[model samples]
Target: MTESPASKPVPAREIISWAFYDFANSGYTTVVLTTIYSAYFVGVVAAELDSGEPGSATLLWTLAIAAANFIVLISGPIVGAIADFRASKKAFLFASSVACVAATALLSTVGPENVAFAVLLLTISSVAFTSGENLIAAFLPEIASNKNMGRISGYGWSLGYFGGLLTLGCCLAYINYATGRGLDATHYVPVCLLITAIVFAVTATPTFVWLRERATPQKLPPRKGYISAGFGHVLTTLSHARQLPDLFRFLLCIVLFQAGVATVVVTAAIFAQDVMQFDSQQLIILIMVVNLTAAVGAFLFGFAQDRFGSVNSLVAALLIWILAIAVALQASSEADIWITGNMIGLAMGATQAGGRALIGQLTPVSHNGEIFGLWGLANRTAAILGPISYGVINRLSGGDHQLSLISTLVFFVVGLLVLLTVKEQRGHAAAARAN
Candidate 1:
């Protein structure tokens, strides 16, 4: 098979800078969505809204997350199409990055009395974060050869885990020290969020300085329909995807399992809080440990992706995820929960890094921006379904988390079955020819 243009290598420094974006974004993901602020939102902000029902805050938090995902799902494609056509990925990335950092920092001011503000800021921050994600991923095709895609993607994910681990470590230490000195965690949680914003800004700077857009700008069609051109890009891809069977098949699998992944990620902290009775300090510690394992998993699976093939690596990771969820179902104690958390880390890193590398390998270099936009769309759809399903189930079951955990297994199992039919090498060849 002939190499796609994306398989051409850029500067090593550019690759490092690109990877650092993952570090930056993970600060928000680990702190706000996964560990501290999510729990803070449910336990502190949304709790005051309904004193009699603990589940109310959890439901609201999930719904807010679902709303943000829906917004991203609707907009990711058009924004991606525009970036591709304009050859302005960095410009859009910078805009989204600023919005996320600013919103995260501003979130420091919101407390229990300001539920609506919390929702508004979260929706904005999540959307901004997602936008940045799509833009950065669009850079992958420009930076690494298909042969190294797995390693590069894996490295980025590993660094993200380190970012998460480092951020969580600091938060855990401060919360421990603060609570020991008689300061309430509620007072300190906002400060932790501010630190996350700073970390995000600082770590993400390298990408702005070093990475360059490689795609030549494509002018929109003359006049009239130009405004809606972005919408047409993804639609055209969807209509013609069967011609690139592997890419299409992989995306379908992503939508299936990634929804499960999204649910597991967003809920892990709150699940610990609501079910396992973990305080902020304990939750941070748990997440830190998970990040440590996740980093290792990303590193190992990335290599495995290159050697064993991305599909095999991803399938193995999904099986681990299935087992992790099963463990979570039986988690009735801290040790049991710890087991679940560690397993999640292992599977999380492997699956995500593998999936990303697989997509990079399968896509034509010219279509990176638009194709990954579809990737983001699939991700956001999962984002919508996973959290909403969890929230609805929680509401229906009176917050029975075990049942919610059980629901995620269907995604992994089904995704794996679908993925079995995909031929990665054939897919890459098809993409190269299409381009």
Candidate 2:
């Protein structure tokens, strides 16, 4: 039997390169999904279609996000399987990155009148973005040891927040300059999208250059095509999931908790803009601060995860999320939101970093890509359900952002309860045996 790549002496450079992908991709989420374009779409593009109705625009945005994530949910496992069979993780990653960058850049062409165009481009870019995210994550177990997985994953996530911060900062500077000269969202927003694309393209290049394809290619079975094989792999793996009970159980927790995280990722700016009357400048600043706190949280919790345990670290983070949501629900001023949002930021980093590390710990090295694809599936499932749920609630409440926001609390609480059942040591032992 061939040795798994997980046992290879992975260099620090490969790990850093792997982390840089996180950094590279963060701009897309920060500028396009989280900070700039989501609010712009809500306040401008879809608003034009809905005659400035916040609920309708919000719903449209969430629907577009849900649609994109739905595609990811269906395609992720298959793509991962194909990459595993063909040893084409880098190829798939590169292709997805190109698609995402090009689609995001073309977003510069979307005007207020082009609501459908906006949604179409957003869906394409979002699909590409998420596919790439899953592919990159599939590299984690290959590059890190079980003991240090949390710290390594934390490094990636912390760097990712910095990447987001830098992207948002540059965009904010441009926004300040453009608005200072009397440019409106029409002129300035396009430039921000273009900037995000350029940054994504440039920053992500190092990942391709430095990251090695460690998986050995598997020979195709007689008469089996890659696609069919891919589907077969997914079904077979899922059928055997009971053997890795803790991993599957944790995936359920991811589905539940990640719903809240996804909702916040897509809706934070919209919530602030609509509920707190935050201007674009204020929104960027708020998110930048959040990014800073998130980075710090990831860094600190990385060590904490190693010292304590993945489950414990994650539980602490979820509790913080519950508190953040509680504060957000009752927030009556910018200061209140600032406080709660930063708390969320802290928890966001810890939860994401800790969760990925735990998955890395629990996953068999040989099935790295396929398993992470399921991770993506879990996350994409949350993305689909969470934002749509929030959108529906907001619309039903007649654009009540506060009420809609409260739904996130339920996911966190339930997720926390589910997480407690994940036997981390048992999961790790199972993966080690599989190896």
- Candidate 2: list runs displaced more than 4 Å: 1-7, 52-54
> Judged by lDDT, which candidate is best?
2
Query: Per-residue lDDT of 203-286 in model 2, one digit per residue for the tens?
Result: 998899999888889987789999999999999889867789999999999999999999999999999998889999999999
Model 1, 1-435: lDDT tens digits are 122434465778888899999988998999999889988888778877547764677789889988998898988988888888888889999999999999999999998778999999999999999989888988887778888889999999999999887777777777878888899967789889988998899989999999877877887876635348888887887886878888988998999999899998888888998898997778888889899899999999999998999998998999999998888888879999999889999999998898888988898777888889999998899888888888778877877888877778888889889999999889989987977
Q: Assess candidate 1 and give its lDDT.
A: 0.86
> Which candidate achieves the best TM-score against the true structure?
2
TM-score of 2: 0.98
